[model samples]
Structures are given as C-alpha cells and as structure tokens.
Target chain A: DPVTGVFRGVIAGCGYFSRHHLEAWRRIEGVEITATCDSDPARARAAGLAAYTSADQMLEKERPHFLDLVTRPETHLELIRTAASRGVAVICQKPLAPVWGEAVEILRIARSAGIRLMAHENWRWQPWYREAARLIRQGAIGQPHAYCLRMRHHEGRGDDPFPAQPYFRDMPRFLVYEILIHHLDTARFLFGEIETVCAELARLNPAMRGEDRAVITVRHQSGLTGVIDGHTLHPSASGVALGDAWFEGGNGRLALDPNGNLWTERGCVWRNDVAAGYRGDSVRAAQAHFIECLRSGAPFETDIEEYLRSMAAMEACYLSAERKAIVSPLKFLVDSQSE
Target chain B: DPVTGVFRGVIAGCGYFSRHHLEAWRRIEGVEITATCDSDPARARAAGLAAYTSADQMLEKERPHFLDLVTRPETHLELIRTAASRGVAVICQKPLAPVWGEAVEILRIARSAGIRLMAHENWRWQPWYREAARLIRQGAIGQPHAYCLRMRHHEGRGDDPFPAQPYFRDMPRFLVYEILIHHLDTARFLFGEIETVCAELARLNPAMRGEDRAVITVRHQSGLTGVIDGHTLHPSASGVALGDAWFEGGNGRLALDPNGNLWTERGCVWRNDVAAGYRGDSVRAAQAHFIECLRSGAPFETDIEEYLRSMAAMEACYLSAERKAIVSPLKFLVDSQSE
Candidate 1:
C-alpha cells in the first residue's frame, strides 16, 4: 500500500476525460482502477475492469478510496456530494458545476465532509503554460503588462453527441465557463487574482446554442490586463496533413524566452513541432500531480480553492457578458454570496 | 510631358500621408509640386516645396491642376470641396470625412465637378495583403471559409509630439475608421460585401482616447464570416510590426522557399508565405500598377466605388460598436438612401 493506503478508484464517466484519467492512473504506482462504471455498458466493459451500470452500484460494491468524476458538469455536483458523503475524495473535471451556485455548494459540501476536492483545471499544468509561468516569475517579459491568449481551431462537427450536452447546449455563457476556464485558470495561475472582467460573447456557429466564440479582457490584481480570445469554430488546416495537429491546427503562437519575456503573436502562421510537446497531453501530467497530492496531502499546484477563484472569474465573465458592462470579481463574489 | 500634361500640384498637409504621396509623386514623370500648404508654416517649407501660408493663396497663385488632401478628417470636407470647385482632380487620404453625411457631400461635389476623387485607400495596394487575396482566390488555403485578420503594433505613442498629431489624440474611433478599414477592405475585396457586422470595442489602453482595440465579426454575402481584430496597443513584436520602422529595427525573420513562397516568420515560429512577385518589394509593384493605370486611362485594380462600399461596411462596424447590436450594412445603406 502507498502512504495514503492504496487509492482504489473507479472512473464513472467514460468519455475524453475518463480516457485520459484511466491512462494516467494505469501508469501511477499503487493506484488501481478496481472497477469502471459508465452509462454505456460496452465502454465500461472495454476498460478491462469489473463493469457496473451506475456510480451508486460501483460505490456500494467496490468501496473505492477515490472517485474520478469525469462526467458532465450537470452531474458533477451530485457526484461530488455523494463522494463526500461516502468519505471518498473527489477529483472532478471542470466546470465544477453548470452554474456558480452549484459550484459553491459542491465546494461547501466537500469542505464540511473534510474530503479533498480537486478540479481538473489542467491548462495550468500544460508544459508551455508552465514554462510561461516560470518565465513570467523570472521577469522574462518585463513585468508582464499585457497578454493575449487564444485557443482556436477549425473543428469539424463530430458525430459524438458529447459536446451537445443539455447543460452545455442551452447555456450560451457557459462556453466561457466550461471551455475557456482552462485558459482563465492558466491566466490566474500565471498572474494572480483577477480584479475586473469585461467580455463579449457571440455564437458564430449557429449549430451550438452556446457562444462558440468569446473575447474576454481581464485586469489582474497586479494591474496587468490580459485578453483571451477563444473559438472552436474557426476554419483550420487538418492536423493529420500537418503531421503536427497541436501546433499547426490553429493560427496563433505563444513563446517564453529564457530571459522570461513572454510573447504571443496570432494571425500570421501555424507551424507544429511534435517533438516540443505542444500537444494537449499535459492532462496526464496533471493527473499525476493530483495523485501525488492525494497520497501525501501535499497541496496540488492547481487546488480546489484556486479553481474556485477561477470559477468566480468565469462567473464574472458571464455577468459582464449579461450586463454588457465591466464587472469586478470582488463585487461579483459578494453579490453571489448575498444571493 | 507624360501624356496627361504637367499638373501644378499642392500637397495640402504634411505628415505621414504627405510623406508617402510626395515620395510617389516625385518619382512620377508628369506631375510637379508647385506649392506646399500646411497649418504650420514651418512644416510647409520643410516638406520640399515652395511654402504657402494658406491653401487660398496657394490655389490663387499656383492655380494647381491637382490637390492632394492629406489633412485631418475635420478639414477634409472644406479642402475637397474647394479643390473640386477649381476642377482639380483630387486625391484624398481616408476617413474621407469625419461623418458619413460629410463624406457623401464631398463625394457628390467631386462627381458634380467631373473631377476624379480617389480615396487613397492604399491598403488594397499593400503587397502582402494583395498576395493573401490572390492566394485565397487561387484556392491555396481551399476556399477560406473563415479569415482571421489582425493588425497591431506597439508604436502609437512616442516622445515626439509632431509624429502624434493633435486630432490623432482625441479621434474616438481610429481603429474602425482608419486602421480596420484597411483589413475590412481586404476582407471585402477577398470575400464580398459584408451583410451583417457584430463588433465589440474596448479602450484597453487608458492612455488612448479612442478604443485602441476592436474585435469585429463580419458576415459576408457568401455565407462566409470573418473575424478582424485590430489593435494599436499591442507591444511591438516582429510578426505584426508596422512600416519602415520594422524593417529598420530588424527584429523579424525573412526566408525564401525555393518553390516561390516568400516566407516571413515572427514570434519565432508563425510562418506566413506569399508567392515571389507578391512579397517584399510588392509595394513598389502596387505603386507601379497605380501609375500604369493612371497612364493608360484604365480602371485601377481597386476601384473607388468598391472602396466606398468598404467604407460603408466600416461605418457599420462603428454603429455596431455604439449600438451594442448587430448592424446590417445593406440595411444601413438603403435606409440612408431612403432618408
């Protein structure tokens, strides 16, 4: 047994997040996925673990130490609450909830139960992001007055119905909350608490109910203002043809020099270097960090508190989008608390 | 005599526009600068021609055949109308007038007088932009379902007050009218007439009065949408660097692909390539084309009517920004006509 006594786990959602977690856990020593549960029985069985139809059955039978909540955002609150009640630490994917109130409740419940909660805000752990943070700390870009972070690609409509989940489809503002929060968390992790947020949201791609595009401006507590523009709807060259899908799919570039000067230039060119690890495989490294934190009670680099603050920023972005005005995080958090 | 008889010309203003025009006209075979007029007498003489205290004196004495109006937006209407009444074929730099009504009046007077009124919308003549247009037309990027155009650089502020004019200090929407019009024209030139425009304007740099940044979404007649982001506030970098200053600074990379792709990569990795004839010295080629058109009495590649339509679309962008609602260019133009 490891120091935390073997953390037997079950992945209850077998989607993209689940695939990443399952693969990472398999590589970590002393961690065992004793069972797997999914709505799709076939997918659950294919994982080579004892298959279960539901999370309740898996929790009741396996008595796992941890439950990796890779399910949809709507299912997240219930899963975390259940895990807390059963004294099972929860490692859930963001958004913590579809709405802010639900996210707060999940955090509150986990706190009362004294069970650890980790939101998989993995962009903070991505190699380039980590390098950016390191360079900024080293003063590479000279006090870092402004940053323009963008994640856009020409994504063809996938046959999978996962992206069109009800909680996702109906909420136009949640696209910023669900998708761009990774970049937001990345901003916070590199800079600090955001002071004010002003944003504009639009649904360019009519197929999705949510805003497929957003341009958000954030003023950090350090007086640094950063703009994040995200779109999953832009047209891009195919990854397979480029042989470097991660770097070449989108027309943007972010680099951190050895002297800590962080530079980002977009709308010029796209070149992918496979060897540099620009791909979105940093989730595996993030999973490893979570496991280490779970075993040693060492605070994770991106903890629940940090994720909650990022959530606060996300909620502020939605409010700014709603009111069509600039919103301060402090005022937003206070108002939400009153509500 | 270069076929079109020698024309005594008075350059109405002395700034960046005047500098470029003087350089181009000096090289032309037919025209000669008889007098120079500017609000500032010091600059008038320094601009390499006989100084005139005012346009009235310059026009009365020199009786110039052509007037190049490169003054501020507020003074454009008066300068253009005065020049047109004298049957002087006018070449004016853009934001032809501060307001659309004024612009229409200027256009009307020029047409009534049977004088040529060229907007000097030089972006259409920019080699790189023209090359991008050609490639898209040639199906290099395969129909270009979407385009992301960005124009940003770091040098809008400087210690020298002369470079930053007085009108420039308070012009509330320079990006939309001046800079973005270039990209907007490029989009329309490459794509087609924009049907609807949705935009978000922000004053990211507090030092600048006008919104220094804007993200505009244009829905073209062809069902293709384009996102054009313009900023005069981004810190100086190699890729999006502006003008002769960038070439002088020497901070970017220029390479040649044996296959005729003239590649320039900035931010260390983003590569953009255009076919050989369309690369570096293509600005001179564009100028040469303009001169050839003038000599042959042939229509210029970028027609004034087409440029006016692009200006109409740009006006829609400002309306969308102010109204905080999607503005339709086709509707706006029709409504203006009806009114």
Candidate 2:
C-alpha cells in the first residue's frame, strides 16, 4: 500500500461550497475522489462522480479511505458516525455540529473510532491570514494588540437575499453561527485563545428569522482586544469580497483589503497577490493539510479539540448577545466536558 | 444693549480645549471676549485677555453677559453656579458635570436662575456630520438602518500615551466619558434618541487608569443599530483625523473618510472638504449658535435638557459596561427627574 498508496476519498454533500472542496480534493495528488453523496440526487449527480443518495451507501460501495463530509452542520453527526463505523478517516465541515452537545458527541465519536478527523475551517488558511500570522510572527507588527474583521456582503439585500444559500434567511441562529464562526476560528488561529466575548446582534432584514448583523468584541487570552463587525444588509467599505480586516500592533497596522492584499501602512512589506482558486486557494490548502496529516500520521491543525474551541467561541458570542454580558468560551467547553 | 447687541463674553478655565473656544468666541460677531480665567494664572494670561486666577473675580469685574465655562467636568458645577449667581448666561463644556447628580443640580441651578445656558457639544456641528444629516434627510442613503464610527488615534501608546492631555492617564472614566460622548450626542443629532446601549471597554495602555478603547453598540429608538468603536492606542484605518464612518441604509452606504469626505459608492455624491479650525470648525459653529440664540431670544440647540440627555447616555454607557447589560439612557433622565 505504501509503494502505491493512492488514497480514495468520497465527498458527502454537493452544495454551493462543496464544489470548492470537490475541486480541491481532485487537485491534491495521490487522492482520488471516488464518489459524491447528497440528500438531493440532483446535487449528487451534479458532482459528476459516482453518485449516491446516502453516505452509508457510498461508504459501503466505494470503501473510500477517507470521507469528506461537506454537508450541513445538522447532517455532520450522522455522516461522521457512518464514516467512523466504516473505519474511514473523515474531514467534516464546520461548525462540526449545530449545538454544543452534538459537537461534543461528534468529537466523542471521532475519539472512540480512533480515525483521523479534521475540521475544515479554511478562513485561517486564506493566504492573507497566513501572511498576517507570518508577519506578526516575524515581529513586523510588534506585539499585536488588536485585530478587526468586518465582513459585509451585498447579498443580504433586495427580495431574494442570499441567492446561493437561501436557507441563511431561515436559520434561527444565523450570522454568528453560519459565518462568523469561520472568523472566530480564524481569530483563534491568528490571535490565540479567546478569553471573553461581548456581542450585540441585530436582525436588520424583516424577512430573516435570525440576526443579519453582529458586532462582537473579542478579548484574547493574550490581552489582545478586537472586534468582528459584520452584516449582510450592506456592502462593506472595500466592496465585499470577504470584506476588510486590519491587524494593529506596536509598529503599525497590517491591512487586508477586499481584493486579498496584505500590506502595511509603512515598514512591513507583505502581499497576498490575489491568487487563483477560492480565497487564495484556502480550500485546497485545507484539504492538502488533511491529506498530508493522514499520510504522515500527524495530528490535524484543526482537530476536534481546536474546532471545539472555535465552536465554543461562537456559542459564547451568541450567549453574550442574548445575556447582554461577556461570555467565556471555556465555560461551554467545560460544561460539555462535564456532561 | 439691544440697539448694538454687542454682548461681552468672558471665558472661564483656559485649558487645552479652551483655546479653540476662545478662538471661536473671538471670531463670532456681536460677541466680545472681555476676559479669561484659570486657577493657573499663567494659562489665563496666555489667553491674551484680561486675566484672573478666579472665575468669580472675572465674572464680577468683567460683568460679562455670558460665561464660556471651558473648564473640566469636575470644575463645571462651581463655575456654572458662579455664573448663575452673577446672572450671567453660561455656555458650559460637555459632561455638564462628572456625575449625574451634579449635572442635574447644574440644570436645576440654570432653571431656577432663569439664565440662558448651553452645552458646547461641538461634534454634531462638525461639517461632515451636518452634511451627513442633510444627506439622510434628502434620502441620499434611504432609511438609515445602521451606522458605525471607528475613531482610533495614535496617542494612546508608549510610556506617555496622551501627550496633549497628560491628565487623561489620571481620569477614572475615560474614552466614552471624554470622547465618545460627542459621538453619542452626534448619533442623537443624526438618528433620533438612542433606545439602548451595550458596550465593551478595555484599557490597552498600562499607564492609563481608565479604559482607552471601547466598542459601544447603540440601538436607536428608530430601530437604527450602530457601533462607536474607538481607541486612543492605535491609528485608525484611515489617518488619525476623526477615523472613519459609514451609514448604511436601504439603497447603499454613506461613507465618511478620515479626511472628512462623505460620499456614496454608486449613486449619492455628498462631500465635506476638510475646513480649517478644530474638526470642521465645529467649535466656531457651536459658539455662533449660542451667540445667535443670545441675541435673537431663541433657545440654545444644546440647551440644558438636550445636554442632560447626552449626559444620561454617557451615564448609561458606563452603567452598561459595569453591569454587563444593555442600558437605557432614558432611565438616568427619569431618575434625575424624580429626584
């Protein structure tokens, strides 16, 4: 197997974002995407692989070495269970699960199964953030004290807001749960552990059940303070690619424009150059990391534990908004552990 | 006095900001600055007017029609009472008093004396905000649903953070009380009364007694949600001058750059060419309004009642930060009224 080790991979869920994952898996060398499964047969057929209605059917039929669960948060638990039962390594899409208990259960299943599991949180892998982290590490911005990410998309306007994902309007816990979770994980990746989160959420669009706008103040364990200001109701100042971000420190500020350029006001010279693929080929990078870790028997960068931390942070943000107080992400983790 | 209507005004407390007030008063027609007072005789003398060590001495000897109390918040009550006793109209600087009870007492004193009083809340008079308000009124950005102002100055870093105002290090309450109070009043001036406020405060600078950074989420009575994210420690995304802001509505967004240019992306075109003087010569405009009101028997725009509301908002912001909950500024007003 080692002499001719070409691992077979199968994708579960062929939704809007899954296409990126599919493309990425195909690009990663020595990885063959055996088949794709989606609840919607049409979407499964759209993947252009051996199609299956159920992940169990695909896992049994293909016996793929790995399962790429690109499904929604709700379906992740069952799909991960199926993958684990089939003794297949799995890379699941975030938030891992919809709630804290389910996320813990997912972690538990992965641990018991002893299968290689990775949470596909690709925002941090976005070349700009990686470059930002490198800059910070290089002492470009001396002792980074603050960071802010403002993500505003024009899609949450007009009659048909969120055209790609219409279900975004219907989710009770949108914004923070659906999107800012990526930012929260990315924040952790860039700024280290989060100590506390105080958030204010608003539902600007009448048709949406959940909050369309959110401003979350994050206090890192390292004493760094930052804000994640995001909304779907309006376009961002930088014209809404992934919005804009800035990392401020002792020297100066490192800014990420909408077009994915990471340049500083002065001194620090770093550029992302707007690479090809999705968000600087972050999906490809994320998938490649999973495959490399599996081949080398190395731990995942976003393992179940790290993903749980990000998930807890998201939970804390929602709780802070509801309670009108600062919430510690650690409390959720500790609570879940006790339970 | 009605024939010429040349009102003689004297300045009390010749501090750092008081210079702008003095300059503004000098520029105003039909208003002559007869004298200036400060406990520090040197500061009073620097005004190049008839100087005195005490406001009482200045008020009695100058017999001015109005007193511009440019002193600090703690000194406001005594100076205002002195002006009231002399039956002199007073235009006091913001935070009418440091505490709620003192501010209410100042209001009561003004009411009982039946003297003309105004709060020098000059930020709303800033040419950009004025243009922004006009644009909103003209439906440039449609019904405004959200606003965010981020003010970051480079002064709150290193050993001596606030060089201009060295006393900033000593203030028990900073940021929101000293600076963002202007933005809160400006928000009221632009988008009606604030229904609730939730804030997260941090002290990034080690030497400062108070929080140097804050992110205050404001929910206006008109359902407009906004944030005032400010810090003294870092330079803003735009340059240091007033940071940047955006008012988002049904149509698009109205953006205000650091250089005082207010413009929309596609349709609307409203601009504020940076004018001379302090923050669009707002101090001059505020003084002009006060002087015009004095001459025409008209009410002051930032009269005692309106000033009290801004004070209440300031109080609520502090309380919200302390209690870790959303607070209504109206409660402070009600509590004061009952007393």
Candidate 3:
C-alpha cells in the first residue's frame, strides 16, 4: 500500500446519492475516500472530503487505487477512460451507459486495457433483497417461477423528486433508465439473466419529457418471468417505500411490501432495522465488494461483463416498447457482443 | 311477451355453477325456466326444473325461444349449432369453442342461421367493473391509458377447485380460455377493443392440463395497454378475491384491490356490496341484458359479432405466447372471419 495503512479511493459526482457512496467507503475498514469531485465546486465542497471541481485534477493529485463514479451516465465513459488509463479500478453507477452499445464499447475498452470494472448495481445488495435472495437460494420459495416488483414511488407527483434531482424533469430516458434499472438488475441477481423483454411505457407525468411509468415483462433464462411494473407519479403507503414485490415459486411466495418488510406466502415477515448507515445498505455492500475484489483479486459480483446482461435487458425494454413486441434480450445482446 | 305472461327458456348443462344461473333466472320477472337439460339425468334432476336427459328432446318438447349453453368449450359449437338451427337465440359460456378456429366457425354458423348469439363474458357486467367503466367514460381517471388485472385466484391448487368442477383440471386450455377471457373482455368493456396482444403463459399447476397462469398484454384501439395477468395457483388475501386491478389515465388512477374494494387515485374507496347475486352478479346482468335485447330487439352487449373483439384478443394471447411475439388480434380475428 506504498507504506500507506489503507486502500485509497476517489469518488466523482457529488450528487444527491454520492454521500451514501462516500460514507460507505469511509465505513469500509481498509479504505479511505481521499477526494470527492463534482463539476460544481460547491457540491464538491459539500461532501467534506478534499474537494476538486475537476475529476482529472482529483485523479492526478490523489492517484487513488479506485475511482467511484456516482455521476450521471453521460460522464461515466470519460471518467472510466480517464481513471482506467491511470491503472485505477473503476466502479460506475447503474445503467453503465446511456445505451447498451456504448456500455459494451466502454467495457470492451476497459477490459482491453486490463482494468477491473464494475457497475454500482446496489439494489441486489439492498439489505432486505439480500435476505430475500438468501432465503430464495435456501429454497424458501422452492424454484422461483415468477417475480414482480410494482414501482409507485410517487416522486413525480408534483415537484417533489424533481426538486432533489431537477434534471429528471428533462431527461429523455427517465423511469426505466434512471430508476427501474436497479430493479431490473436486482431481478437478474435474484432470478438470473433475462431472455425476452416485452414492455409498454407511458409518460404519466406531463411535466416530464420521458416516460414516468412503465410495465416491463421479462422472461428469465431459468423460465422465471419477472415484471418491473412502475408508476413514478403514484405514492405508496410511505414515501420511502419504493415498491411492493414478490417472487413466486412452486411451493411458496416471497413478497416485499412497500414498507421495506419481506414476507412469505407462508406468513413470515422480515424487517431490515439495520440500516446500511451512512453508506446506505446496498451502496455499502457494493463498494465493500469492489474493495475486497481489488485487494484479494476476487471476481466482482457486478463486474462490467456480467452487469452488461442487465443493461442488455434494459436496452431491450426500450426496443420492445418502441416496436410493440417481445424481443429476446439475451439473444440480441449475445449477437451484438459477437458482432 | 306474446300475451302469454312468460318468456320461456331452456338451459343446457347442469354443472355446479348452473345452480347460480337457475337461481338468478328465477329472480328475473316474466321468465319461466321451462326446462333444465343435461347429458346426465341426475344432473338435470338436480337443477330442479322440468328435467330432461337431452337438450334436443327438451327443445323439441318445450319449444323454448332461447337456449343457454353452459357446457364446456368442446361441446359449445355443437350446442350452439343445435340451438341456432332451431332459430333459438343463444347464450353460451365463454371460450365459445375449444380453439379460436372453432369459435370463429361456431359464430359464423350462428350468423348463417340468422340466430342471435352472445358469449357469457360476465366480468364486464360485474357491478364494480361497470361502475369503473362509467367513471372512466366520465373521465374520473382522465384519458384511460393503461389497465392491469393480476389474477391470483389460487383455485388451481392441488384439488381445491377440482372436486366441484373436475373438468377444469382436465381442460386443455384453462386459465386464459376459461378465466382471463373475462378480464380481456372487461378491458374492452372498460376501455375499447384491443388492437394487438403480447403474452406469456405458464402452467404452474402441475395437475392442470393447460396453462393456469398467463400474462396477456393487450394494446387497445384507443391506445390503452391492458394486462390480464392470471395465476390460478397463487392465493390472495382471500379465496374469493379474483384479482387486483387498475386503470390509469392522464389525471389519476382507478384501482380494485384483491378484495372487492374499488378505489381511485384521489383516495375514494368503493365497495360493490350488492354483489353479483347467485349467477355471479355479472352473469345475472349479462343474462338480464340478453333477455332485454330479446324483448326490445336491441343489440346484445356481448353479441357474437362484436364480442369477437375480446375473443380475438384471447386468441392472439395464445399465438403471442407460442410464437414469442406480438400479434394483431383484430386483424387475425377479421381475417379468420373472412376465411
């Protein structure tokens, strides 16, 4: 560690969610978040780390072992390229890219340069989801055949979510890209890679330019049919409740109510009172996983190569909605990869 | 009402559900259920009407002006033809035939014989659904853009819904044909006729011969996307709660809980306590509507010709699921009708 007692990391994009990432990195025993960078100096300063307005400046000065990208997807490619060239392992946020082709190319470039890359797919690491997956693997639900997550965060109701994240009101790719991607990636973690995607999207909120609601049906390779049903304009019982979800198998069903409780068809309920603390649960777990992988040379759970499957599913959802059809996501992704 | 003070009707197939039909028929004014016929003499006798072992013998002896066919889909075509040829207006149970081709031919035969025909697609006529449709038309939820009915009757469990209706366990096409067709019809009733269908089916109930669970996505002519998600193996809060449903438009959302409670996005709850009555409130309304049309020469709500819209959607669901593609039900039905 160059006589340094701890592993080093730099985080870019001091947005609304970066606090969780920085806090998470800080919580990890072996790591220190050396610097936090954002385009806006105020946001950088707000993070309370050694702040830099330019990510390149932070990377040059801190020379961190890893770069944590909590920025918008538009900036991820440049950050990944900028960091990977300096032999920095990279962890970018969900979606990975604005589109699948670009994500594929970005990963290809990173891999060719021998850089360890991972997507910050945190939903799979969410405390409740982690417990749910554990039970699922233990056959609590007996071979999961169907999974559904109904998303109705109601953030787009008026100016609520828009106030915290103003760019959401104008993004061309909103619901599925900015939000539902987490659920889709979680579906992959719980169910496996998706095969086909049949989707229908609606712009429920007139103020937003892109779709705020969508119903995406995904058929997993394991014969598991998963649906990511969403309505950003509708509120749940509580504001924190993202959605109600269930994974059904032959013998029983595993359900997650909007209130963050995991329940089973057989009448067992689990609550995750142990919040992830400053890092947030999944963000903490995801960053911890990346750090461990960096140190021990262990394979990442959401390595860019594997994370591309969820991205491919996301890409297919858009295509399916556009074409009004069920398109095979895995087949399309695999074919594109071959090309 | 030929000054006789009675509207005579003969009902065929005295299965378990027929008792509800007979009870509701008794409640209707000016109606005399002259005969109840079944292939089995005991079943006919159990119906407690002027019993007959054969429908043809009952028709010849009683000379009823209308026939209600409550038999299985396999027998639907023959019974429809038998009654229609005698110039009797007919009310037949749904899944008019075993397949789309046969259903098409049966309707064609009825039309050729100049006899009126209607499918007993009663879900649309349910009290809550009717109210929902009325409110939707009145713009309670604004533009009526999306619809979803998640079916979780759990009736297909081991031997629960089997002992009474053994045929369901044996039917080659169960859920979508016998059940989801009702919701698809309801979608049309609430929104408009469907233009395209994208679907996926699963046979969760190993005991059942056909798929007991399905997700049928229908795009209506009005640009409304409706999902009839069926799963006969999953239980809801109660056994009687058919499915949870919602119809979303630009302004708000209209939802029906797994129980009978119907509500709006504005938080107004509605419960249809009057219930559909013995024959199923919808079945009663459907029959009453049929009788009114017979008396006043008005067109039937689910008249075979127009009702084919829903049947087409159901047919397309099978095709879409089988082919893993979206299909035009209207185009398919119209082309089949022309053929």
Q: What share of the true interface contacts does each candidate keep?
A: 0.00, 0.36, 0.18
Provide TM-scores for the models. Answer: 0.73, 0.94, 0.91
Q: Local distance difference test, per candidate?
A: 0.64, 0.85, 0.79
Error of 1 at B294 (Å): 7.1
DockQ, prediction 2: 0.46
Error of 2 at A262 (Å): 1.7
DockQ of each: 0.10, 0.46, 0.38
Q: Mark the regions of model 1 whose C-alpha exceeds 4 Å error after superposition.
A: A1-5, A15-17, A40-42, A95-114, A150-181, A192-281, A292-338, B1-8, B29-33, B40-51, B61-64, B98-101, B108-115, B152-154, B157-178, B194-339
For residue A94, model 1's alpha carbon misses the true position, in angstroms, by: 3.7
- Stronger candidate by TM-score (1 vs 3): 3
- Model 3 residue B99 CA deviation (Å) reads 2.5
- Which residue runs does candidate 3 get wrong by more than 4 Å? A2-5, A45-48, A157-161, A235-238, A265-268, A274-280, B135-146, B159-161, B235-238, B247-254, B263-268, B272-280
Report how far off residue B327 is in candidate 1 (Å). 5.7
Better of 2 and 3 by lDDT: 2
Which candidate model has the greater lDDT, 1 or 3?
Answer: 3
Interface RMSD of each: 12.4, 2.2, 2.8
Sorting all predicted structures by lDDT, with the top scorer first, yields 2, 3, 1
